[model samples]
Every structure is written in structure tokens, then in C-alpha cells.
Target: MRHTWRWFGPVDKVSVREAAQAGAQGIVSSLHHVPTGTAWTTEEVEKRQQEVRAGGLEWELVESIPVSESIKTMSGDWKAHIAAWQQSLRVLAKAGISTVCYNFMPVLDWTRTDLRWETPIGARAMRFDLIDFVAFDLHMLQRPNARAEFSAAVIEQADARFRAMSDEKKAALSRNIGAGLPGSSDGYSIGELTEALGRYAAIDAGRLRKNLIHFLSEVVPVAEELGMRLCAHGDDPPWPLLGLPRILSTEADYLEVLRGVDSMANGVTFCTGSLGVRPDNDLPAMLRRLAPKIHFFHLRNVRREEERMPCSFFEAEHLEGNTDMVAVIAAIVAEEKRRKAEGRSDHQIFMRPDHGQEILEDITRGAQPGYPAIGRLKGLAELRGIERTLSHASYGLA
Candidate 1:
């Protein structure tokens, strides 16, 4: 595993120098100033790369050059958006950034009801409470047929939760879920969001997936030609939410995507925390099975509340979540070994410690919601220790 960190450009609270100091081998970043669907110029890509190199690190992966919503729904100048997306890929490749991470989650990128859910250790972490989300969907957003989506028990609980909250708390919940996070596409206002969800009213998981495959069919060839790997990030929580269909949430989803495009350039950005939300995901086993198509990794463990669909979850210490950290690391290390045996140059997958808990100095530093400086440094340290141990053990007797 190649140690990597996601840096949100020069304006980020966590500087590139700090990232290098934290022992990151490379930087995962993006040109956030550019609007979605606009083609990134080669000059812009190189300028960012220069910044990364100046801090003594290479820009190995573009965390994302976002996919346009038009492309997702196949509406509103989608062909033009697809052409621009392809051009962006060409530009990125020319700038020597090989791996690109993106997602197809409609409307919001990732939803968290609480940005600072208090941890038992007095640290703060991002969390998604199922009841809170249901409250927003049924009582707050008031989506059509929202009551039908959840069981009566869940709806009743959500109603109580919704009725108990003050107006301020309700608005906070709305913003937390609808407002964009760092490196995501954009936020939606309540009115704007309702309209957006309305567009997807007829689009189910199957149709949305078909749209994704159609996208891959067009872009994967360009990626292949440019020697770039396009990594589709899995949906956070790995389930549908707010009536929007979620397709990229399971191993089966990935298999469909991989086989649909049938190109080496078509790959997945194996995000353990996102997929780990589902008890059925089997992280280590999935890692072993889909190792070849894993172009990048967002390595973080999530502690699932009830071990079922729509369960609450929060970011845990890198080694302390429900995921078997040691086993997952072993599978990754083993995959690298197999790739090396086959003489593949890109055997070492780029992985970054994702969504670290806010603790220590990070609590007051007010870093990006989940990308706290000290918190992620601590995570990287723990993950590095694990990687070193696993790598050493693979060598047989020392």
C-alpha cells in the first residue's frame, strides 16, 4: 500500500508540507475551483502537481474531477458534459496523474446527520444516525411516499424524533445532509433538493446503474487511451437514501460495472468505510476478490451500530472499527505481492486514511469536518504500523 493523503489544494487547512510530514508518499487532490462538467486544462493539472512536488510529494491520484449531474440523469447537455469529462481525463493523463477517483451518487455526495458526534474517548467523529435521516426524509424534506420507504416502527420513531427537535436543530440536520462536504460536487437547498429528487422519481437502481455503465462505456475508452485508471467511488452507507437510487454500493454492483465496461481502465476506488456499513460486504474477502480492479483505496474503519441495513455508523480509529484491520491489510499486502510477481508496475495501490476522528489538537483546530490534521496523522501512523508488520510477516522467517 502506498501511503497517500487527500489535500484540498493550497487553501486547505492541512498543508501539503504537513501531509508530507505525516509520512504520506503521495497527495490525493483536485482542482476544486473548477466547476463541475468543465474540462480541466493541462496547465491547471500541472500547476497542482507542481504544488504537490514543492512540498516533497507527488500528486499520485486526483481525489476527483467530479462527474456532472447532467451525465448522471442523461439530461441537460449530457453529451457536452461527457465530452468535457473525456477532455479532462486527457488533460489529467498528460499531466501524469494516473488514477482518478469519482462517484455517481446523485444529489448529495455523502450524508452525515452529525459532523461532531461525541466519541466515548471525548473525541468527535462524523456519524449517520438512521432515525435522524428517516426524520429528515419523512418529516423534514417531506419526500413523496417517504412513509412507505421505512417500516412503521421506524417511521413512528422518526416522527417522534422529528417532533421533539427545535426548528434550529431541524435546519441543522437539513444542512448537514444536503450541504456539500469538502471535495464533493455541490449542496442543494431544500426547494432545489426536492426538485432534484423529483427528477429521479422514476429512476430506480437498475436505470441509474444503466446510466453509470453508459458513462463508463464512453469514458473508459478514453481512460484506456490515456493510460489513466478511472476509479468509481462506492456510495457511502451503501444504500439508497431520500428516495434516490444507489447503485454503486455492493460487490455485485462493482462486478456489474467491471464487466459492463470490460476495460482495465474501468476500476473501483475501494472505500472500506463506505462498503463496511453493510454487514454483507465482507471487506477482506471483497478486497481479495476484487483486488485487480482496485485502483485506489480510502482506508478507514466504521463501527456499525446494529449490524443491519440503514444502521447508524461513525468513523472509528483506523484500527478499532468493526472492520478487521489486520486481515484487510494482509489481503492488500498479499495482492501487492501477486501483482509484483506478475511484474505489474502499478502493484502498490494508493491508500489514504480517510475520515479520522477529531481528537487532541484537532478538536480546537477546526479542520475540515472529517479531514482533521492530527486525527488523520494518527490514523496514518496506525495504518503504517499495520502495513509494516504485515509486509514484514509476508517475507517468511526474518
Candidate 2:
């Protein structure tokens, strides 16, 4: 595994030098300033590559090249958007940036009900509360079908949660849910967000899955030709929110997409925190089964409030969460070993110690929600230690 750190850009609070010093060999980032549906030009790609090299780090993966809403719903200039995405891949491949990550989550990228949920030790971590989310969906956003999506018990809890919140709390809740795309500073107002959700009202889970398969059918061929690995990130909470169906949340979901595309280039990002949120996921098992096609990995843990879907969760310490971190890492190392034996050039799968607890100076550094410096450096150190110990022990030489 190649140790990678996510850097937003030159404007990022955590500079490339800081990431390199933190022991990251590669950078996971994207052209955040670029708008959705636009092809990333050769000049732009090379410019960012130069910046990474200057900071003594290789740009291993573009965490995303945003997939447009038009592409998701197959509406309003989606063909042009698809063409632009293909062209962007061509340009990126020409620039020698072959590994990329993107997600198919509708409206908001990853919803966190609280950005600074206080931990026992006084540190903060991102938390997703089910009741808060339901409150936002049913009472705040006032979606027409919100009641149908949940049980009366769940609805009652949400109603009670909504009723207890102050006006200030309600506004903060709105802003948090409307917290738009990852990496982008832009967000939406309640009105704008409600309208965005409305666009998907006619599109159900089956249609959404078809849209994803169709998308892969169009783009995976381009990725294969370009020698690129196009990885789809799993849904953050791994459940439907605001009536939007999450098609990429489970192992079955991935198998369907990979088989639909039928190419090595169509791959998975293998995010533990996201997939592990669901108790049924079985992280180590999923990694072992899907290892060959997992091009990138987001190694983090989440403390689940329960074993059910739509349960509340908070980002936990790398080794302290419900996820068996040691086993997950072992599976990854095993896959790397297999790939190396097979003479694969891309044997080293890039992984980042994702979503560390906001501890130490990170508390006031105002770093990106989950991308704090000191905390991630700490995580990388812990993960590196595990890899070293495991690697040494696995060699049965006398």
C-alpha cells in the first residue's frame, strides 16, 4: 500500500510539504475549482502534477472528477457531460495520472448531521445522526414521500427531534445537510437544496442503478483504453437519504456494476468507514473478495450506534472502531502480494488514513471537515506501524 494524503490544492490548509513530511508518498486530490461536467484540460492536469512534484509527492489519484447531476439522472445535456468526462479521462491519461476516484451519491456527496460532534476526550469528529437526518428530511426539507420511506416509530422520533430543536439549531441543521460536494466550498440554501432533491423524485433505485450501469458502459471503455482505474466510492452512510436511492452501498451493488462494465478499469475505491457503517458489509471479507478490482482504499473506521442500516455513526480512531483494522490491512497486503506475484505494474494500491479524529492543534486549525493534518499524520503513523509489523511477521524465513 502506498501511503497517500488528501490535499485540496494550493489553497489547502494542509500543504503538500506538510503531507510529505507526514510520511505520505502520494497525494489524493482533484481540481476543486473546476466546475462539474467540464473536461479537465491537459494544461490543468500537468500544472497540478508539477505542483505535487515540486512538493516531493506524486499525484497518485484524483479523489474525484465530479460526475454531474445531469449524468446521474440522464437528463439535460447528459450526453455532452459524458463526452466531457471521457475527454477529461483522455487528457488525464495523457498526463500519466491513471488512478481516479468518484462517487454516484445524489444531491449532497456525504451528509454529516454534525461536523464537530464532541468526543469523550474533548476532540471532535464528524457524526451522522439518524434522527437529525430524518428530521431534516421529513420536517425541514418537507419531502412529499418522507413519511412513506420510514416507519411510524421512526417518523415519530424524527418529529420529536425536530420539535426539540431551537431556531438556531434548525438553521445549522439545514446548512449541515446542504453542505454540498466534497472538496468544493460551495453549498446550497434550503430552497436550492429542496429543488435539487426534487430533480430525483421521478428517478427510483432501479432507474438509478440503470443510470449507473449505463454510465459505466459509456466511460469504462474510455478508462480501459487510457490505462486508468475509475473507482466508484461507496455511499457515505451506505443507505438511502431524502428518498435518494444509494445503489453503490453494498458488495452486491459493486458486483453488478463491475459485471455490467466488464472491464478491469471499472473498479472500487474500497472505503472502510463508508462500507463498514453497515454491519452486514464484513470489511475484511469484502476486501478479500473484491481485492483484485479495488484500485484505491480509504482506510478509516466508524463507531456505529447499532448494527442496523440508518444507524448513527461517528468517525472513530483508526484502531479503536468496530472495524477490525488489522484484518483489513492484512487483506490489502495479501492482495498486494498476489498482484506482485502476478507481475502487475500497479501492485501498490494507494490508500489514505481517511477521516481522523480532530485532535491536538487540529481542533483550531480549521482544516477541511475530515482532512485535518496532525490527526491524519497520527493515523498514518499507526497504520504504517501495523503494516511494518505484519509484513515482517508474514515472512516465514528461518
Candidate 3:
């Protein structure tokens, strides 16, 4: 497996050189300056790709060409936006930057209710508490159907938290949820966020998933023709987005989308941490089955709520999560072996430590989605150890 680092364009605090030194062979990034609904020109992609080559690393993937909200909800002029996306794909193909990772999570790319929740180690990590989410949805946004979405037990817990909270604390909670957290398109206020959520309210999981398939059907071939892969990462918890259907939460979703598009380009960034959060998920079995379409891999661990109320989340060590890391790595090793036996050069999967917890000296600062130095460094080290240890076991020849 070839590891890549997600760099946030030129302004990223972490340099491409740093990424190279960290042992990443490829850079997973995007044209952050390019707005949604606009085509990313080949000139821009080549310019960024050049930077990677000069840094002694390859530019293998564009982590995203952020799909517009217009395209997601089919609001207005979506065809124009989709056409632009297609054209951009063609442009990227011409430039030879093929592998791309994108998400379909509406409004927020990913949500965390608290960015500064104190960890037991006295470090700050992003926390997604159920009560905090309810506090934002019911008390702050005051949606008409908010109460219906919560259970009696959840309502009781949320009510107690809401009552105990000062106005400033409540407002902060609302801002945390309403503001769309970080790594999303942009910050959203209460009104803006509620309206955004409302746009997807009419869309159920089936329709949303259908839309996602529709998108892949259009763009996947262009990628495949150019020998590129489009990897879709599953949005975490509650499965699908609040408004849109989540087709990718289950193995069937992956199969359906792959069949819908019928292109080699259509694949998945199998994220163990996100998929592992669900108890029913069997990562190794899924990997073995979907190995051909597994374009990218995300390795991380989550500590599930042991006995907590409402939402008891777990943030475990990279090797210490609910999902068996050793087994997952073994499956990956098996995939590599199978692909090699089949004479496929595209078997080198990309892996990254998805989201790690904040720890050590990073306690004082804000890091994007657990991208702190200590956390990621620790994760990379741990994952490297696992990969090396398992490298020998899975492929006996190694």
C-alpha cells in the first residue's frame, strides 16, 4: 500500500516536503480555491501536480472536486453544474491526475458537536455527543419535527443538559452544530444551516443514494477511460446524511452503486473507523468481497460508548479500535496478493490514518479533523508497525 497525506492546498501549515519526509509517496489534496459548480482547469491541476513532483512525491489524488449543493438537491441549473464537473474530469484526465476522493454528505462534510471537548489525557479532541446534537437541533434551530426525531430517553438527557446550560453555552452548542463545524464547505449560522438541512428534508435515503449513483454513472466512465479511480468515503454515524439516503452504509450500497455505474473508476475509500462504528459491519469480509473496487483505505480506531447514555463514543488507539486492525491488514495483504496473481498494477491501495484524537503537546491548538502532529504521527507509526508486521504473515513469500 502507498500512503498519502491530505494537504489543504498551498496555505496548509504542513508543507509538501513535510509530507514527503513523513514517508507519503503521494499527496491527496484538492483545488481549494476553485469554487463549487466551476470546472477546475487543467492548468490549475497541472500547477499543483508540479509542486508535488518537485517535492519528490507524486500527486495521485484530488481528495475532492466538491460537488455543489445545487447538484445534490437538484435545486437549480444542476445540469450545468454536472456538466462542469464532467468537463473538469476530462480536464483532469488529460493532465493525468486520476484518483479522486469525494464525499456526498450534505450541508456538512462531517459533523462534530464539540471541537474542544477535553479528553481524559487533558487534551482536546473533537467530540460528537448526542445531547449536544439535540441541543442544537431542538433548542437552537427549533425545528418543528425535532422532537419526533429524538427518543424519550434522549429528550430527557437533552432537556437536563439544555436546562443546566447557560444561554452562552447553549448558543455555543448551537454555533458548534449550526456553524457546520470544520472541514466543511463553509460556516453556517442557525438560520442558514436549518435552511440547508431543509433542502435535503424531502430527500430520503433511497433518493439520495439514487442521486449519488446517478452522479457516478455520469463521471465514472470518464475517469475509467483515463485510467482513474473515484473513491467515495462513507459518511459517519446515523449512516446516511440527515436529508439524503445513504446507499453506501451497507455492502449492498457499494454493490448497487458499482453496478449502477458499471465502471472500474467507481470504487470506495473503505474507511474502517467510520464503517467500524456500526456494530454489524464486518470489515475483513467486506474487504475480501469488495477488494477489486476498493480504491483507497482509511485506517483508524473508534472507542464505542461502553455504558454511556444516548451516545457513548469511543476513540481508541489506531491498533486498539473496535475493528480488528490485524485482520483488516491481513485482508488488505490478501487483496494485494490476489491482484498480483491476477496481474493488476493498480493493486497498490492508498492508506491514511483517518481521524486521530488530539493528544500530547497539541492540546493548545486547533487542528483540522484530528490532524494534530502528535496524534497523526502516533497513528502513522502504529499503522506502519501493523503493516510491516502483517506484511510477512499474509504473503508468506514476504
Question: Which lDDT value does model 3 have at 61?
Answer: 76
**Against the correct fold, how does model 2 do in TM-score?**
0.97
- Return the top candidate by lDDT: 2
TM-score per candidate, in order?
0.97, 0.97, 0.92
Instruction: State residue 394's C-alpha deviation in candidate 2, in Å.
Output: 5.0
> What's the candidate order when arranged by decreasing TM-score?
1, 2, 3
lDDT of 1 by residue, 10-73 (tens): 8778889999898888899999889888999988888999988899898989878788788999
TM-score of 1: 0.97
Clashes of each: 0, 0, 5
Name every residue pair that clashes in candidate 1: none
lDDT (Cα) of model 2 = 0.90
Residue 181's lDDT in candidate 2: 74
Off by over 4 Å in 1: 393-398
lDDT of 1: 0.88
lDDT of 3: 0.75
